[model samples]
Target chain A: MIRLNRLCAGYFGKTVIQEVTMEFLPGKVTVLLGPNGSGKSTLLKASLGLLPLTGGEVLYDDVDIRRLKRRQIAQKAAFLTQSRNTPSIQALRMVLHGRFPYLTYPRHYGGQDYAIARGAMDATGSRQHENTNVSLLSGGQRQGVYLAMALAQDTRTLFMDEPTTYLDIGRQFHMMRTARSLAREGKAVVLVLHDICLALREADRVAVLQEGRLLCLGEPDAIYQSGALEQVFGVGVHRVDTPHGMQYYCVPQQVPGRIAEECQNT
Target chain B: MSSLRIFSTRRSDIIFWAGLCALTLGAAALGLWTGSVKLEPAQVLDALTGRDGTSAAARIVLYSRLPRTCAAMLAGAALAVSGAVIQTVLDNPLASPSVIGVNSGAGFAVALVCAAAPLAQRYTPLVAFGGALAGVLLVAGLSQRTGASRMTVILAGVAISAMFSAGIDTAVTLVPDAISGVTDFRIGGFTGVTMAQLAPAAGLIFVSLGIVFSLSQQMDILALGSDTAQSLGLSVGPVRITLLVLAAALAGAAVSFCGLMGFVGLIVPHTMRRLLGKGSLSLMVSSALGGAFFVTMCDLAARVLFSPFELPVGIILAFAGAPFFLWLLFKQRGGRT
Candidate 1:
């Protein structure tokens, strides 16, 4: 389990996540939902010890992550962010780099590393185009490769930021399903997602953020109730029970003057 | 094919690279053999092997051609490896020691040493090395604020190069006697190499290249961006700084001996990238051999093209490298959209 105690982080001098506290349970999929600039990504980065924390501490199994060496942190948790700038030629080779923590100085990949990388490719369903340049791959395909790289680390915890942002609907589902399977394998998965409906469908627990503070944290059903989401999003939310399960949808708020002007113009 | 069979298919690539190495070595040998006072292949071998027959031929081969060949080989390999490392680190094909002002900085330092102090003549390599390190640090400091954007780093390099060249011009103008020597150095050539001058620079280049080769795998990881590198447990900052220093040292050592020698660093690694697959080991080795071959050939062309009088090898390299670079740019552009 990864736990954050009153963690505060920011860029330069200004704090973005202000004394926010949260914990990620092992073998569970936790979805973080927040509006733009609410520090979801910052929180994820802080947990990885990528961004320096101004106060408080982050712990993995009660051991402080900050006190651990960088390689040790990598061994315990693997992080994936949206903006990957890897060169095209180095795509699959980069996936193999996840084994770096295990190797000594003057590191070289051995047979075991290759085996793990191959297994990751298979698990993420990215084995087919392993040799293709990453830049030539579609957005969804590239995400799959990145997911494979994170999986290749073989950490107990995985953190992703907006992993499905540029993906098509089908690919989005495919990625979410992969995340779900990873959770089923007893890995703690923390994801910062923009899509509320998808988060409701996939996440075991949902943590709602407003203005860099945790507003609600509970099971998906409790967090997805009408008033909870309505208050969080500042809009009307409708909870409908279908044959499959409980479904939550946001009702659009009509702006009177803008619609009237558009109608007149049309 | 079985997986083992498939793996064995890369044998041809190895053979092809080995063939290129052989071809380049042959060219270097031919260069050493044929000159203004040409020696037969047998006489050249005798001269090289320290056999008695023609003392004059031995003098020409050992004193004139041998140092020049060694200088060309060392400079070429060093520059090519420097270019490849810079390109990989910056993730920009345009990033080279020459293009990014590292060479110009060393040249400027040499010019300064020549102008201000008599001791500069005795310690050219040290001055050049200091200047190269300073140039790399300056460029890194200037470009890092913008998060080391590829264009920003290249542009900063161009600006630093221009500034250093201007400084060199002013210094050379003040001391008219130093003008010709500094000018020759700036344009880059191997006309004035002696064994005494070649040994120190060659040693530095070899040591730095060894360092670069040792870190080649980490460099491959870093070619992917910082986040990816960090997630893989490679510290990005230290690795980048180490590569920058390595590239600067190699370029500095080359400039100290052979002046600027612009295009080998820019062209050889790029050419090798296309010929060999982009594996770091293959690229590093091929780049070294290809660079040596290129400079040796260019120096030979410079010697023969002007026969009794020699032109700076830099001119010939620029003449060849510029067009090839333009062709590559156009090819990349055409492929992009």
Candidate 2:
């Protein structure tokens, strides 16, 4: 389990995320949903110690993460950044980097490490291209490789920032399903996603942030039912029931008296 | 920590290393044989084995050509390995000792030290090493202050190189007597390099190479970008600083003895990467061998091409490297890293 208490962090002396408290429990897929520059990514980075917190502490299993060494933190959790600067190396070798903390002096990776990397790739559906260079992979395939690396870390928690961006619709669903499966396996899977419908359908819980503030945090159904999603997004959200289960969609809001004024002018 | 293997022992990797070993041996032989007074390969071998140490051929081979050949090979290997580390740390394929002004920085320091104390020639290599470190720090510091982006590093390198070159020019002007000392260094060469001079530089190169070898795997991780490296449990700042310092030491050691031999660092690593993939260990090994072969062969040409009169090996390298670099740029534009 990981908890962020009153976390405050940002770049160049300006706070991007302020006074945010959140907990990521094991066996749950917690998706952070927000618009651009809404501090979702900032919060995740701050919790990981990637960005220095000005006013908070991140506790990993009741211990302050700031007191832990980088390698120790990495052992407890793995992170996948949104930007994928794909290295020009074979997919298997790139995935092998996840075992880096386990590797020591002389910097050699053993058969067991390779096997673990292979397993991670297989788990992420990137096994087919293991022998190929990652630069040759498509965006979706590359994202799979990155996920494989995070999975290969073999940590208790995994954090991904926009893992599905630039991927096709099918790949997006595949990624979400992978995260769901990973959560089901008892790892805490945390993500910042832009797709609200996917978040509602795929995530076990959703935390919505607007303008660097957490507006709502609950199960997707409850959050949608409470009308917090619509209020946060400034759009009307419609929920419908179908054979596929509850479905949510967004519609542009209408002005209160502008319609009547336009009718009178016409 | 668990036992790990960062590089797989592939058949292709074996073949590549073997090929490089053969090329290095051939280049060393040619370098030993094709000087101003040519010696047959058999005679060169016999002289090397001390079959007749008193003979004129043996004397020339042992006393004159052997040290020069060793110096060329060592200098090549050092520069090439340094370039590989620099490129990885900076995440820029265009980064190299010469491009980033490390060579000029060392050269400037060597000239300044020689100018200030002409009799303190024994300290030249150490001063050069210090200058190289300073140069890299200046570039890194400037980049950090600005944006530390790829373009910022390159631009800062250019600016630093110009400043160092100006320093060298000033030193030369202020002390005309230092011109004689700085001449060979300015136009990098193997002339007049004795076993004594080669020994210190060799020690520095060897130590720095060991450091580089130990961290080669991490270098691959660093090349993936800082964010990725951090997530993988690497303390990116310390690792990057160590690599930069090692690279500067390697290049500085080479420049102290070989006089700013350019392109070997850039060309060798790039060539090795093309042949061996991005595994840092294999790339580094191949680059070392390839660089040695290239410099030894170029030095041989510099000696035998015009015979009685010698051209500086740096000129040969520049003439060859410029066209190849252009071709590389075009190829990169056509493809993608």
TM-score of chain B of each: 0.94, 0.92
After superposition, which runs of candidate 2 have C-alpha atoms over 4 Å from their true positions? A104-107, A254-266, B1-10, B179-183, B330-337
Spell out the clash pairs found in candidate 1: none
Across residues B114-224, which tens digit of lDDT does each residue of candidate 2 receive? 889889888877988888998888887676667776766888898899899899989998987884645566768888788898899999899988878878778878877
Please write out the lDDT profile of model 2 over residues A59-94, one tens digit for every residue: 989899888888888888899898767666778888
**Model 1: CA > 4 A from native:** A88-92, A130-138, A226-251, A255-266, B1-9, B328-337
Per-model TM-score, in order, reads 0.93, 0.94
lDDT of each: 0.82, 0.85
> Model 1: per-residue lDDT, tens digit, B99-157?
88889888888788888885557577778888888888788777666676666788889
Chain A agreement with the truth for model 2, given as TM-score: 0.94
Across the candidates, what are chain A's individual TM-scores?
0.92, 0.94
DockQ for all models: 0.51, 0.53
Q: Fnat per model, in the order given? A: 0.40, 0.58
Please report how far candidate 1 places residue A100 from its true position, in Å: 0.5
